[model samples]
Target: VELILIDESLHLQNGIEAILTMVEENPEILDDYHFVENIRQSIIDAVELELNYLKTKFGGTTIFGVSYGELERYMKYIADRRLIELGFNPQFGIDQNPLKFLQKEDVKKLTNFFEVTPTEYTNF
Candidate 1:
């Protein structure tokens, strides 16, 4: 498998924000749903802990100390797509992908584990 390490703080925050936004937009969905209430509360508690840990350890940097240039842009792109899938407006307006720096040949090499076609990989 191709290993891809992501910044947990950023990813988690994106997820939390999406969930919170969904709840805000559809408050009625939680009115009689104890299961949804429990899940939402658990997410809030976990997100609070994660935010505190990230702030304590990373300070102002969301990616910790990793310096994968343009990776942040790619992440924002993906986050925006996720937000769209969640019925929320995209937060970032980035169009170009930083991972586009990877050549088609290199992407082909990763296809064995990535399970994406060369064209799909390049577009991604």
Candidate 2:
């Protein structure tokens, strides 16, 4: 299982779509009408639980975190902590880089200093 948290629901939908593309090509995972609606409801409920817990623990202060990673293991730790804080489980998957499909020099100019290609750099 993987838990993905985003500020906006649409962004979460997009990320889930992209992740499903890499994980067995199951269109069922991306269907909001068929699947996501129910899942989303549960996630929202869980998030509320987490928010209430945080409010009680921190006197209603906003929660924020920063993390960096170059590997799945480390990324998972960061992702897990954040998602668990939101009352969800973490799911592991590669980060998708839409830039890889680009033929333009935009990605090269931006990522020239790094040894890995745009797709590789986007993993983080």
Instruction: Give the candidate number with the greatest lDDT.
Output: 1
- CA lDDT, candidate 1, residue 71: 47
Residue pairs with colliding backbones in model 2 are: 2-90, 2-91, 3-91
Error of 2 at 14 (Å): 11
**CA lDDT, every prediction?**
0.51, 0.41
lDDT of 1: 0.51
Whose TM-score is greatest here? 1
User: How many clashes (backbone atoms < 3 Å, residues ≥3 apart in a chain or on different chains) does model 2 have?
Assistant: 3
Write one digit per residue (lDDT tens) for candidate 1, span 53-87.
Answer: 54566555545344333444555555555555544
Off by over 4 Å in 1: 1-67, 101-124
Q: How does each model score on TM-score?
A: 0.33, 0.28
